[model samples]
Target: MSDQVDVVVIGSGINGLVAAAELAKAGWSVALLERNDLLGGFIATEERTLPGYLHDTYSSWHPLFVSGPAYAALGEDLHRHGLEYRNTDYLVTASVADDGRTTLAYRDPERTAGLFADSRDGEAYLAAVNGFLKIAEPFGALLGSELRSPSTILKGLKLARAAGIGLLRDTVTSGRAYCRREFHGDEVDHLWSPWLLHAGLSPDHAAGGLMIPVLAATMHGFGLPVVAGGSTGLIEAFGKLFAELGVQVHTGTHVERVVVEGGRAVGVVAAGRRIKARRAVLASCTPTALVRDLLPRDAVEARFAERAERFRYGRAAMQIHVALSEPPAWSDALLGRIPLIHLSDGSGSTGIACAQAEAGLLPAKPTVVVGQQHVLDPSRVPRGAAALWLQLQEVPFAPAGDAAGELDTSNGWTRELADAYATRVLDRVAAHAPGLAATIRAVDVVTPVDLAAHNVNAVHGDPYGGAGELDQSFLWRPGPRGTVPGLWHIGASTHPGPGLGGASGHLVAQRLLG
Candidate 1:
């Protein structure tokens, strides 16, 4: 049987959902297809550990989505469809050093600055945030718009006018260099460096010069937010919105190929049936998937196909969900209040861990992102129990050796290996939160291998989709145009890199609507 739609969106991730919703609202008939029995890709929640204890299976934070252009356009509409956010006011985020010294950033600039030992560092942090805000509009423009779009040039001009050539000069500078120059002491650096890991980058990576300050400014501006229930709340709202708009959502149906006729994506073969797209086809998939597996060999030029083949995915990552009997007894009183805390000494420690992971070694002391969701929304856990959302962004998908030289890497991410690594990570957390080991009810570990199995687009368990390196980002995001005429790429693998921003989807929808 054959069916027709104005647009056929493959993969019901954030990007795909955004595109489908936007198009459907704009008077287009859309079909949202997914391979899994459920939608939302990694943006899902489940009782992974125990009944009644909800956990975000993958991405739990909503900083990017809350502040992104897609949210700006769809936020009101989504909120009307049963979407709710549980956010913090003063105690936003904090980082703990190996020495047990904690660096905290709050919603208020003055309050956050006061946490630094050196008063000058506090002043410096505030100044840096203000300085970035001066050029944030244009900077956000560059990030939000397509690299090849004329608006990018206009935004570039606005940025140059606001910040001067000095801003452009730092494009090649590493994040570590930028942080060192901006802040006076390790306290400020320690607080923001590990955040680079979220952007699929390390402290030493290029473009940190811009990202480091921008991230700080953004956090201060729009403190981290989470769905009231879990990450699933956001997608579930989208599902409701889609249904109201009459969008045909086909879950558990895989698109075997993006059929191309006359050098354009005409339709897709899914469920052993050809579903024709009357307008455009948007793929929220990896460049490799779109170019090699889906599209015809001649759909794109040979050169473009070669570039897709060479598309590099960033380091592997893992998520560990810990069901606690009660709230952790943090060593620091201030840390217990903060919702999100990083158990790392800042740039120095995270840099070493990234280096080790890149060298195919399990980082002996990996950076552990301890997300205490129960701090803000008590609904996630039952009664007094707390849920811990631990994220390890720096890990090797296929380990060649262990940095601590204790684990057996010969088996490569086996169940035993994943459990051992989770134990090590939990030990790190236990150092900061005494008696954490005893309070644990259950542990669910999603290793790099497991991440790949869950979402093939992750490509070797890279949650960010692909590398956010200077060359691979912006204009060079696997090239400016899609492989086929009527085909479009709107996912983390595309420009603007990863995260829940959904920038790529918003951009494609705007173009198509225009």
Candidate 2:
């Protein structure tokens, strides 16, 4: 490999991969470095439980990627290199309460609204989603671009004129409040409230009112898509594209520090070798890590470093993969066909769980994200068998105690504790699917500690980089331009916060290329 390149990208997450591929395609020599042996950071697929069941280890859905500008740029290339997606045309997702009431969401908004009890709620639901769609282009552009840029200001102005005062008011209102004001029925809240967790927000958090409509519009427009074979298929496709573009990939290479001279980032010292970067060095890492560990103390201002130190992380997360002997026998037979379902009862229950997790206690009834990947892609499991990708977003990294007071929290996230929590989550699922416990052949649990150990970017087991509070989001988010010249920052930690969007990386690459 050459000792020098046009750009040196640190970390091989979705952000790093996108930046490297885009730059290399633009005829710039790029080198991508990864600490792990594998290239994909969070996106991985493995047979966690049984040989035939292929499970997405971390993130599964791709609604954001399919709808983002990154996909608009690279989707054709990725598809050419063996990237295929499986999506349902009708049933996308649903939510079920303990009382066996199921609220379904379809690809068609009118069809989904028809399921609501009150006809007014159906009308309100349609209005909220369609209202957002009218300004979706400008809103999406503002989120995808550099927030502090002049172009962003114009986009925001355009959006304000189109959306009026309601958009501004919704930014500060909580999802709970938005649902209460918009619709009398609990159906809309029950279906979309749990989705806030995916954005690193709670049902009661600010900006959720805005996010709920965005989520509804996205799911309805794109549908929930998973890669054809596994989530790793996207990574494999990127690998093929990288090779075709002549991008150098160095896996198992830990970049120790950025080499700065004359207040400019010239390269990185990885594996005790100094590989020079003639153009730029993009670090796909947490702001704290970039300011504290990667760069020299004198490279950045002290206040910036201190602010990075204060970068708060939200609640921890856990993944439970279950291999079922057969499909779960849900009490509501319709639930068996939905791609994803949440065990939540709107803000009333989900709010309590978020509060408990923040207070360092295990939630008694945590919002469970049940993903049925096999329903969209039958190749994920053996014929006549199934698997469940269960996600627990409302979890404490270090539990003070269990809210149910059943598990021992003396030891933080030990194997026994994780197993006990897994049992609780499964029991919650079993409530909706009476035969769930009986159908399980094997269960593999990935606790918060496991998440932290697996990916350095997942600080404190927060897979979304950092907390997405109003203070840390939008114009306040860290931009690509760092204090040091030729250094850029991208990833979940940057603006356009988390999810499978890859917006941060795409934004940074466009900045460099322009």
Candidate 3:
């Protein structure tokens, strides 16, 4: 009994951590293993940026800040955990056409509406948000409720209730349709379109995608907040819980393979050692990495592997972080707040950006996100210095005409690509913030290939697991079943898409327990 435990989880990312945490909370001992030198998939920190600067290597904003059960459950009361979130309540969104028309979304929607009073769309903004939230009520319940019931009679009722609420139909429409029908402004639509990226689809595709409001509600409920340190803080908080719970979180360990016997997972093999477990095995890695590399081919059904391969991994990002002496000055007060920014001057920019990789066009003006992390959390940057992350879409995982385009881990080109991407952000932001570039002291960049090489969870450089479209949802996600009697999967790649909410992790674990 001493040699064995209740469960063995591979990868210390949020999915693995949460699965372990949930099981341990239920009085089960667990042994969690991470291949990487550290824990937390994308919610990680890197000192590589500079000596004192701590950059959230992947992401800083948690759209599910309010609605995510992980944060909601964890609450502000860390109880000696030393974790706190400071929110930047202003969204400085602008369209850089002949006229740089910028709109501000305040913590207060009414105030956000004031910035657009002259525009008809501005007046409708509040109402549209209200309507979206109103429609979201039932949809929220549908996502939260257990879709499975012991009896078919109960399951039928759940289905009926969901369909009656118009959830079924709306979820079957594209994001473009949803936005066109709900909001009446160009910028509002531009602002709302970011949600489509979550699903890994262009707004134009008739892919039956309508999950924008859930994301909006999550962000609105709590402005996309970040801890004072970085994303690593969130992951470390879980590590702390694992320690208190006595769950063994081993770092710097590489899991070579998943140990399976008699048609069921038994444990894992790492560092030429076999760590056996009696309870169960949970894989928090990518479907491809888990199946192709970690697990034996025959152990996992070929159909499952095929499905995992077929799954669409969404848009790639070319990211850059600048260690600046001063905040970039903008055409407007972009320095004031706003975690994410959008572009607005294309026929179907949202959809076009989504299809750009396939179409072979590096968009003239791609969706650019300007996240001034140091502005929101000063602790992340060195004293008298700031860190700004600027990421552009359409930077495909496998770009054409590049030798090391997809997951380029071969040469020194990754850091170089990162630098080039950073320069673009500096220039674009400088377009409005004329004085911004002059203040820059140092820059750190992470290209699409860099992201994939670093985190096995984000295959093909897509940060949000698989495509969050209608085709890869709920039961259809990854593969069949929430938990396969002895196996479990969780993370941003799974159902409910990515972000800090850890709601997917909670649901996956809850499903296992239930």
Q: Top model by lDDT, which number?
A: 2
Candidate 3 Cα deviation (angstroms), residue 187 = 3.1
Q: Rank the candidates by lDDT, best first.
A: 2, 1, 3
User: How would you encode candidate 2's per-residue C-alpha lDDT over 382-422 as one tens digit per residue?
Assistant: 99999999999999999999898888999899999999899
lDDT of 1 by residue, 119-163 (tens): 988888888789888888888888878778676888878778998
Which clashing pairs does model 1 show? Answer: none
Q: Give per-candidate clash totals.
A: 0, 0, 5
Model 2 regions more than 4 Å off: none
Q: lDDT (0-100) at residue 271 of candidate 1?
A: 88
The count of backbone overlaps in candidate 3 is 5
| lDDT at 369, model 2 | 98
Worst 10 residues of 1 by lDDT: 478-487
lDDT of 3 by residue, 129-202 (tens): 66666646555544543444354345445555644645555577676786676556565555556555545556
Candidate 3, residue 425: lDDT: 49
Question: Which TM-score value belongs to model 3?
Answer: 0.87
